[model samples]
Target chain A: MNLIIGNDITIGYEGEPVVSHLTFSVESGDYICIVGENGSGKSTFVKSVLGLIPPLSGKIVFSGGLRQDSIGYLPQRSAIQQDFPSSVTEIVLSGCLNRHHRLFGYSREEKARCRTMLERLGIAGLSSLSFQELSGGQQQRVLLARAMMATERLLLLDEPATGLDPQATAELYSMIDSLNGSGITVMMVTHDIHPALNAAGKILHFSHDGYFFGPKDEYFKSEKGMTFMKEAGHDHH
Target chain B: MIITEILSYPFLSRALFVGFLISISSSLLGVSLVLRRYSMIGDGLSHVGFGALGIASLLSLSPLYVTLPVVVVSAFLLLRLSQRKGGGDSAIALLSSSALAIGVAAVSIGGVNTDLNAFLFGSILSVSRSDALISLAVSLVTLSAYLVFYHQIYATTFDPAFAKATGLRCERYNNLLALLTALVIVVGMRMLGSMLISSLLIFPSLSAMKVARTYFRVSVIAAAESVAAFLAGFIASYALSLPTGASIVIAHMLIFIILSASGLIIRRIHSVIS
Candidate 1:
């Protein structure tokens, strides 16, 4: 079933269109990789999908019983976000901040879920430690755990591996792949698309000329996909 | 001790009571502001308070009535400016200098030089009974506001974009925070004065951060540290006949230095043991 559908959308800032004429749908358990160069509106498109920014023209409908704020988001890490003075547990547990209607403290079940998320992310031992003291790989894992606490269905990740080492990148991609295998839909935007390209069932490639969105198998045969692969020196079967 | 005799007086007792409340409120709000790199907003808003106080003195009106709304509006303006791209530190500097200029002009033109020292540096003896009551009431309100919105404040201060994506109204919470900060700064100005009030917000949070790792502990420790520093400063000022604001600021500085030194010593010892 289609979880989200974006029809004829134009993502931009301050009413000036950056990338226009886009259409896509995310089905359940499908992994979509949005690939593009800098200033290609990949981030803008993701922001629109997440409802962080309003689209200039088209409508994004979230069907299949998804609420407005139900999508989990793992934004790119900046220096200020990295230096946040919070514990791993506090950071992860805050994912449930808007999940409830009440304004009081978290329930016992919510606390239990946080523990489960930390354990699932394999950072259970680091729950009490400061988030900033962790390595890049650990921090990303903690963030993933936090996002997981928000929603178990769909996740929107914007360049989740921007400043990581090769090994850390591999580990993060593997984690994402495993999550996709467990029936969660993922829409990730990244410039480094080679290693994670295999996991994506669909590709949304934004370019200076225009944009393309389709199944991965068809993308492999499309002219734009072929050009993108050749330019990035990435081989896809 | 002379401190015992000093505390017997109603004015000194009122000063201490109001000072304690301001210290607590400022430190509680300070942690989130410092982490968000918006610490300078406190200083900027205090300057706005100075300007409002000048106008109030010229009109012979209640300073709190004029200063509260002016500072609160300025806080919101600063918040709006900070949200815009490329309007961070420079905006703060511009607002602060303009307010200071307006305040200086108001004082000179109105010829309120007799009360200039009190407005700039603060005099505890000059605090009227009604002003103390206002301070207490506002401080309580600020404290309650922080307590009720602690979770939202935590999420927004850490990562506002993520918080907004999760359906939390981060901007509203930010505005609420700014409003509370304005209240605290205005009340604190009565004791800490305009020139030295932001120190109450900055010093405690920075000192607490040097030792604590978690946000909750940092806020709690900051409040304790601020209250202690204020008491020490007030007592020292009375004993030595020093300027109240300067003395309080100096005490806060000394405490910060001591905390930093202790933190360094502990780290060194741990390194040696390892």
Candidate 2:
């Protein structure tokens, strides 16, 4: 099931183009990691896919016939304020803000779904805790839980393990692997390649100059991939 | 006591009602401003309102008519300039400083026989029926706008990129929030005086955030706190024959300190228990 297709996509800010002539198709249940340098348009590509930035020129087709509500997005946790004074439950409940509900408030079923998603993510105990008080790893889990409350088909994560410790990173990736195994498509943008590259089936290498779309095995086999990794001082496993 | 005399007067009742209405609008708008990190913009816009008031008094026009449009237009310009990629904070600071300077100049230069004390410290006794009606109308409009666009505001405030990706028009709503903030400042100036209005905008909301876990609860508590502060300040001012605006601001600060201390204590206890 093809969930997203971008043909000849070009994205950038008002004056300059960041990434151009990019083409890719993501299927349901496919776990893809995008790797690039700091200014390499990885986040831009993700944002473009999510319709945050209008492509300079291209067509993005959502072939699975999924509505906007079916898309779950976990943005960079650092981008949000930790001391925002919202409970884990309240933050998670915001994922359902777009859903149809009664005139009064969220239905009991919605509340149950929120609780279930938190429990499924193994953070049910943090439900009543202030979101700001959670550890970085715990905060990411709560955000993931919130995203799950919105959709089960596709999860878009922007650097889910950027600030986590080694142990936490391993745990987070394992969780992601399990989620992918359960048939949820995951697209993540990250600057660090080792962890995500090992976990992702497909690696999308991006740069301000261009991008390469291929499987992980083929990526390491290419000359450009070797040169790119060598220049960044990262050895391939 | 002076408090007993003020409490027994219908004029004092009217003043308290006006204060309450302005506080509600300020607290609600304050949440959006704080989240956007434009908390200082409240102070800036209030200063602009002061200039508008001076202009209005000089021209013998109703201060509300002159100040409302001036402050709203200033807010619009502020939003417009801030939307440019790297211009947000600088633009707000520039506008605020210029507005304050111009306001001070206008008040001094106009040499209008208007009572400067009433303009600076607030003269609740001078709050006419028409001013009350205007305050009520502004409150209704601001509240209705908030209720209607609550989801959009929440989305944009939490994650602008996500909100944009999800097909929500963030710029429009962001500007609308700014416009509402301007309206609240203009309306609140009559109660708190332009110099002190921004305190009413920020203090209660900050205090509420110290304790409330959800945005909804924070807003509710903020509104309640603002009303309480207004009542206490009004009574204190009457009792001590102090300046009403200063008294109200002091009351709000006192509440914020008390609430913040209690919140700290509760958090320590929770950590220990957990």
Candidate 3:
């Protein structure tokens, strides 16, 4: 089933229309990798999808029982987070804030689920430790656990592997890949192509040339995709 | 002995009472403010309140009635300015200086009889019964708001993007924080003065962060530390014949230095042990 459908969507800054009139649909349990250059309206597009920013034109419809708040999201780390004073458990528990209805604090049920989530992500022991004390990889894993607490059905990660070492990056990709295997739809934005291509079922590449959205093999066949791939390949080599 | 002296003097009793109440909310709200780098909003709002006080005294109205709404509106405006990308410092500077100019002008023109120095530097020793009552009321409201919306505030402070994605109206919480801050600053400016009240918001929170790893501990420690400092300073101000606000700020500075030293020592110990 199509969890999200966008028809003739135009995302841009200051009403200039950079990535204009691109129609796409994301299916349930499908993994989509969004590859783009720095200024290709990717962040703006993602914010529009999250309802943080409205699209210049057209609308994003969330069907198949998916609410906007129900989609778990892992935003790229900001400078404010680097030295932020917070414990791992506190951060993970904050992810369940959407489900929390009563006032005061988290419920006992939510606490248990977060504990289970930390154990699943293999960071239960670190839950008591401060976020600032963790390594880059451990911090990403903790964030993934936090994101998962928001929703089990869909995860939207924006450059989740920005600063991790190769080993940590690989583990994060596999962690996400396994989560996708468990029937959660995964949409990730990344600059890393080969690793993303390995895990993603579909590719949405945004470039100065144009925007291309299709299955992985079809994306390779597309004009912009082929050009981006060659350029990315050369850069990496 | 100190208790006996405090009971005998209305001024000392009022100062201690109001100062403690203001410290609780100031330190609690300070945690969020300092972490989010909005500490200067306290400074800005107090200046706006000082300006409003100038106007209130000129018009023969109560200072709280005038300063409260004006400072609160300025807070909301500051919050709006901060949300617009970056450069919060400029906006705060522009507004605070302009308001301060207006305050000085107003006070000089019509209300020279009112001591402008007291408003700028605070006079904890001059706290009135009415001022203490207002401080008590506002402190209770601010503290209760913090309690009711504790988790929401935590999520918003820690990760606003994730919080916004979770259908939390971060603006409402942010505005609530601003409103609470304005209330506390206005009530606080009565005794701590516009110049020194921001120290109450900044010192305890930063000091607590040195020792506490978690946000919860940071908050608890900041409150306890702020109240303790205020108590010590209040008594010390009386015993030594020093300015109450200055003594309290010095007390905070002393505690901050001690905690930072202790944190460095603890980290060194860990490095050696490990």
Q: lDDT, candidate 1, residue B224?
A: 96
What is the lDDT for B151 in model 2?
61
Provide TM-scores for the models. 0.96, 0.91, 0.96
Candidates in order have lDDT scores of: 0.87, 0.80, 0.87
Off by over 4 Å in 3: A234-237, B111-114
Model 1 in CAPRI terms: which quality?
A: medium
Residue pairs with backbone overlap in model 2: none
Candidate 2 chain A weakest lDDT stretch, 10 residues:
A96-105
Which candidate ranks first by DockQ, i.e. highest?
3
lDDT of 3 by residue, B1-274 (tens): 9867976887877777778889999999999998887887888888898899888877878888899889899999988877667747898889999999888888887757455887788886557788788889999999999988988998899889889977889999999999999999999987878888889999999999999999999999999999999988888888898878889999999999999999999999989999
Tell how far residue B80 is off in model 2, in angstroms. 3.4
Residue-level lDDT for B134 in candidate 3: 82
What class would a CAPRI assessor give candidate 3's docking?
A: medium
Please state the error at residue B48 of candidate 3 in Å: 1.5
